[model samples]
Target: MPYIWLLPAMNKNIVLASTSTLYEGTYLDYLLPTIRELYQGVTEIIFIPYARPGGISHDDYTARATDFFATAGITVRGLHTFDNPATAIRNAAGFFTGGGNTFLLVKQLHTLQLMTALKQAVESGKPYLGTSAGSNIGGVNMQTTNDMPIVYPPSFDTMGLIPFNINPHYQDPIPGTKHMGETRETRIHEFHSQNAIPVVGLREGSWIRVKGNRITLEGALTARIFEQGKTPYELKTGAIIPF
Candidate 1:
């Protein structure tokens, strides 16, 4: 008789993309190749579409994922399809939360009372993926998001899956420009005035890959790290996040 052995213990696999669309192509073009390995054995993905980019319907958002994942031989199911979102999260083999308005996304999670369940799933080593607004809520709070308060959520708190906050689509100051607008850095600095948590400024084309206790920078672009009372510094690709 042959014995079936259990899989070896592995770290929690998490992908937090800065944005969904790249300048060159469709959604998740850059990460598609690498996604297969990160999501090994995951034939189904639970798609969370509460963010509703440009007010897109949940079905449309789910279809976007379905179209993309179909090529990978995976099936995508929207959380909205299930009668109980909490139960869906609890039983999900893997998860993918799309990009959109952070306020809208957070509000829906709280209203549905699935925030805790989602966090529990991620913490329990479920393969989790997030982009833009989805990545924003994976942090300590939604205070760092660039979007305005189109709608107010019951709380600014988030899943806290990661210890720090994330500011996606982070832009640097333009050279010799006269706009005189507050730069992304300045806004983050203002946020630091009240909050002591670290904030990562993830520019487009960059991302954070979390494997249990380690988070390394990925992509061609460098990410800016904003620590309380310290000057922000750039982290090169492959650099382990130093919190």
Candidate 2:
């Protein structure tokens, strides 16, 4: 039988995207429509750039997101610029967390004691968007992330906004290749060997949409699902994730 985990009653409005940029596309080019809908009626939002992709400064990362959201008539301010990030999160109309190194991002959030605050804010129905490493934090923990351990966090525990974890940027093995490296599925299976949490392998161009208590897969492609013991399966687009 397939595994099922019940989730708590929630008031979440979140978009956990697999990646920020798609092949041959500009930053956030593909998700602009979704962004408009997710943050509807909200003119301003806070951008969490703690991931700091490629070691870019917070200001630079924020600028990248700012430029992208501007097209949708929304303004973005970096969380690092505020006196108290936790306070800012509570006050912000919406939030967007850009992609980068998951380890570094988790460390900063934990070190600054803002994880719980952010979680509370989002749980209160504030619109929240996460891409790549940012989306990893939306899971039960960051253990399924595809990032190097460049920094250690106080704990692997994430916000647990969803009942299960997610493996962002999930890819399938090529039909015939001699590379012999461990596939993404292999790593996830190993995780199941020790952990019971279900994992959704979110492929590029796909995202998980959360509205209140309903969680659904969004995009044109199918998503791979993995449970502890059952054989992995594919979830079609627009289908509610069974957790």
Best by lDDT: 2
lDDT of each residue in 37-93, candidate 1, tens digit only: 778999998999999999999999999999998988889999999998898898999
Instruction: Estimate every model's Cα lDDT from 0 to 1.
Output: 0.89, 0.93
**In angstroms, how far off is 76's CA in candidate 2?**
0.4
Q: What TM-score would candidate 2 get against the native?
A: 0.96
lDDT of 2 by residue, 2-27 (tens): 22222223568999999999999999
Clashing pairs in 2: 5-243
Per-prediction backbone clash count: 0, 1
> Which 10-residue window of candidate 1 scores lowest in summed lDDT?
1-10
| Model 1 residue 136 lDDT score | 97
Worst 10 residues of 2 by lDDT: 1-10
C-alpha displacement of 13 in model 2, angstroms?
0.6
Clashes of 2: 1
